[model samples]
Target: MSKRMNSGASQQFVIIGSGQAGGWAARTLREGGFEGRIVIVGEESHPPYERPPLSKAVLTAQKPAESCYLWSKEKLGELNIDAVQGNRATAIHRDRREVELADGSRVPYDRLLIATGARPRRLNCPGADLPGVHYLRTIEDSERIRGSLSKGGRLLVVGGGWIGLEVAASAVSMGVPVTLVEATDRLCGRSLPESLGRFFMDLHLRHGVDIQLNANLTRLEGNGRVERAVFGNGEAIEIATAVVGIGVVPNTELAADCGLPLENGIVVNESACTADPCIFAAGDVASQPSSWLNGRVRFESWKNAQDHGVLAASAMLGGDALTRDIPWFWSDQYDVNFQLLGVPSVGNQVYQKGDTSSGRFTQYFVQANRLTAVAAVNSPRDLRDAKRSMQNKSQFDTTGLVPVLTL
Candidate 1:
């Protein structure tokens, strides 16, 4: 077992970034019988909340912003957590064991957690900083985009990643016309294979969304707000509101400045412990070892945020780490529930089952007769079984895996 914090002493557990990971870590510390002074610092004024709904329910105005909050003020108070809101962590003074904030405050910690989540990669083009070009990372951002969609006009969505697709779907659901621009030829190029990308393409295309592939956006041309977008292909389209969902840049400045190992993100062990024994990192800001990947990887999924937070807290309290599961993530686009379990690569042989015409099927990726990854469209049960197959690393069984479609 790892050495626990000295609870007998006036232990001060300071958590930086009150996002999913930080909030859960604070609660875990309290729940794990650590009677310590816990403080959770967040740049946002709101308490810890889930961001998944921002592109889905919240964007479509199906749910209120408060519904995404993981903890209410009353709940935070009940946990005895000193919630410091609306303060950016400027620097980490490792020698002094303190973190300096933008407000000229230094908070000390016996154990520190760096959960500083990532920020949206702003669109870089002419008139990019115009008023109408928005990025969705917070509830406030989502609400603003929702307002824009409600006003009724063509919404220009840039990037073909999950964020852009979700935003486009939400707008379509809101009965707003959407024209999606992708620099690449397909959607979610990094995560999805060509076949899966086609699935998404068909999904959006069927929904009456104008998808422009290999269409590089040159610039935004407008008077006040963004009124039009120019493409490298010498085509321009007038738009009412614009949303950029290119990607996110992980907030690794604090970790890098403080001298914690940084790669794509703050390097940490499976237990979420950093190189420095006094500190740990988790969530989107953490790049930790993954058995599934056979290497270290940084995940930007909601599952990673919550699980890593709990793991970090357990490690802090000298408790056994939680069971690591296969990295799984799901997306709700239009009316289809798309999910993927395990990391899919290009070389894997895909054996697809079920009918895509019905809009419910599972695609299995196998290499060397072993299940490597699985993608499902509205087939949660098969996806659940796929998780078990992945956990066992079982050889492919064609008994029930009869391929109706092979990719």
Candidate 2:
């Protein structure tokens, strides 16, 4: 209804998934002066909200669920955007240029953006569907896990990834004992380097967390809820509550059903355009070619969600946002603020500017004398300093009274 266009025709933009990507896309469209009918379909009850805090702040009771909100319902109305909450998009009728909803209504769209995001990967073992088995992806999930922690029982965290480590840290902050198990030999094998995993292991161990490596959780046992965990080695641990932080699976069934290409996620170009020119994809559900990583990747991070959503919307508005910026990710656990930038590979030469024993250091991943990636723990300033080397083919400046480790 807000007409900024000079054309005689009206264009409608519809976005699926009312999460970070969807919300930002809606805002970016209005900001770009796309005077058209914008409709956002959300499966959740709340408007688009941040999820990074759900593991740490919300789980530890440091912040309320309201703190995660990005935009309120009234804000969407102010932008003249129709945000349909508590409803899901059932199908996309591409032939009709319409999206069929669960409520049996079809919304016609001139162009569509699918930011469906992803769902937590569930375990296939027995007793996984029990009431006490929790997954942290939403505000309600965080609150439910927090409630379980407050009940005064030992919490078993499966998978030693970011989510698992954060949940363990949150439990420790609340005086709840935690036992973390990782199927691999080290923690965060997929996201972090092997050397960095040792630092995280030591950090959790210092906080009295029972961490088990090269461990596999075979099944959960309880009367009506999760009470015990059975490992692969026939060892069992008494756990009152369980939090599974394995990973996430992209929601690509919708795109797949509509006959779109899928490779790990919805395949998109650098401009976030899919196989169909009229439809685009972004955020966790989109597998786009990354200029930073030099490969097609589906990044599930807050940085990617915000940046990619903006890029998609910009491209939709006839603007050029055909780029994947350098990957940036951060996590907060207990007193640590760990940040990771760029991709870390085994071939990169690892270097550190500060002692790991001090619990604050910056690690650089160098390739051919050029810094390609950086990982910092509690050293935001040092991390920012290392970023310049990522562009220049120069050695890291480790001058003056500092400990440097080259591995």
Candidate 3:
């Protein structure tokens, strides 16, 4: 048990895990006119920062890591939010409404928010513990990748998802020989359609990125540092470093320990409230109920996390508004910006509106005669309109979409 801080009659609100969701919740709470003592606990040394730039812009030397912060230190001070950085929350006592930190300290709160977020999944095999193998999920990881790429080194990337593909693009642009391996037959098999995946395969191959589909890694071979990777198909590739981008696992241990409803993440109602009214969970760590998608879904996107933060804060302030914003996600790869709007899984039919070969197009995923999702590549105009339509649940004639784009 940790020592509890005496809040001294002040209405204290403690938020666990100060990443994107935590930062947004703190800001929203103050903005919502809750003049409570807002305390945000984060495990990272730095304040809450954006993660999308870690693999693309920051790794490619296109942007600085400092530019990714959601709020400045001075801004946080002005908001009167206490940011407890470099400290991990070990447990949550729901009965007492207190949070325990790793350093044997506890903070009592009138209300609590869980925004612990997710962590990158790691490869577990021989030489997996090697020092040179890296995963990009934080600013430190991006800085290390940028430093390694500066040497023009040979890089082996595991997984063919958005993170792996984006990092491979950056490495190749830096004149680094890169090989990307995926267990699936195509890149982004879970997120993208086969046509788009094939297009990405060709695009990466044309850009000098060696992409190996349906390739599985057996083990990582090295002395103390990663030197080579052995594929399950009896093929071995020599490389100076390897990056593993095999998705993320939600940090739901705390919620689970506290006996909160958890499926893929911390389960919450449509209002982002847990079984306990005083406690709320949001962001990637939250399996929130979405009326837009007609189900409870956990989204691991930057925008979704921020939106959940705002919604959860509003709910805590006795606001009953429901969040109907269609889930949106974006990724930047090789000078191409890809944006996805709405729930792609709900789409039954897909229509491509522009030339995919030119890498500027929009693919609409339609379900039950309604547009359910839209994936736009280098087409921000379509992406914005698609988001608006999804939010309004507007029905569009598939045949007339291309003409609308022209106008």
Candidate 4:
């Protein structure tokens, strides 16, 4: 148990995990009139940087790793943030109101925020730890994978999720022969509708990517390094390297050790407040309730991190701000820019306008005739209008909207 101590008014605001959420939280606190001291402790030596570009721009060498930084020393200094890099918060001593660092140092705080992000979910096959096995969760990982691409060998992408598909697209663009494998029956089975999944399949097929669905991996057979992958059906494919982009597991060990309530992630209400009054959580680690869906959901997106940080900071400052914003995520594959608004349900009626084969279309998902969600591919204009209609809770009228949308 931690020592109990009274918190003084002069105590500083401490934030653990200096990713987008932590960076934005520190900045938002200053903007929200927090005049006391602020300290941001980060495990990574590098200052806050964006992770979305790691899979695309960074892997393609189009953007350098430094280009993704979220803040400069001057910017953080201007905001009065004491940036402590290369330090990991080992434990949260709630009773003492202090966070213990890996280096045996402790930082006292009146208010503490945990934004420890997440790590890639790794597989446990025999050759899973081989030299060629790679996962993209950080800039360093991207750099390693990009270097491997330059070596020139057949690449095997395991997982058909967004990250896997994006990496596959980038590999294809580099003129690398790629083989993508997904355990599910279709690509993006967890997110996109069946029709959209087929559309994506067609798009990738046209690009020369050999996609295999409903295929399960038995093990990776290699000598010192990966040379081939064995499937469950006794089929083996010769490959030079492999990249896995299945999903991520939130960094909740510290929170769990502190006895914080967790369901999928650290439990928090819409206001981002944990069970402890002085402690709060945000970003991927916080599972917040959603009034739009009338349930709790955890969002792991760049926008969610930025928005949740601001909202969590406001709540920590004794403000009554709660976020009920619609969740949106986008992916860039080849030449198509795919965007999804709100969460798509299985039973929602899908309506398509424009031609999908031509790489320009807007998909409207209506629940009981009320516009609920929108998906667009290379059609930004329709996406904007569809978003407005969905937010306004307008009923979709095919006859009335045809003239305006050219349906």
**Residue by residue across 257-373, what tens digits does model 3's lDDT show?**
999989899989877889888899999999977765677789999998898898888777777855447778888777678888876663357777788778899988877667788
Stretch of 10 with least lDDT, candidate 2: 1-10
Error of 2 at 346 (Å): 2.7
Local error of candidate 2 at residue 60 (angstroms): 1.8
Say which candidate scores most in TM-score: 1
CA lDDT, every prediction? 0.88, 0.86, 0.84, 0.85
If both were scored by TM-score, which would come out higher, candidate 1 or candidate 4?
1
> By the lDDT metric, which is better: model 2 or model 4?
2
User: What residue runs in model 2 are displaced by over 4 Å at the alpha carbon?
Assistant: 1-9, 391-407
By lDDT, the best candidate is 1
TM per prediction:
0.97, 0.94, 0.93, 0.94
Residue 295 CA error for candidate 3 (Å)? Answer: 2.0
Of candidate 4, the 10-residue stretch with the lowest lDDT total is 398-407
Ranking by TM-score: 1, 2, 4, 3
- The candidate 3 region of ten consecutive residues with least summed lDDT is 1-10
RMSD of each: 1.6, 2.8, 4.4, 4.0
Model 1 TM-score, 2 decimals = 0.97
Q: After superposition, how far is residue 286 of candidate 2 from its true place, in Å?
A: 0.6
TM-score of candidate 4 on Cα atoms, chains taken together: 0.94
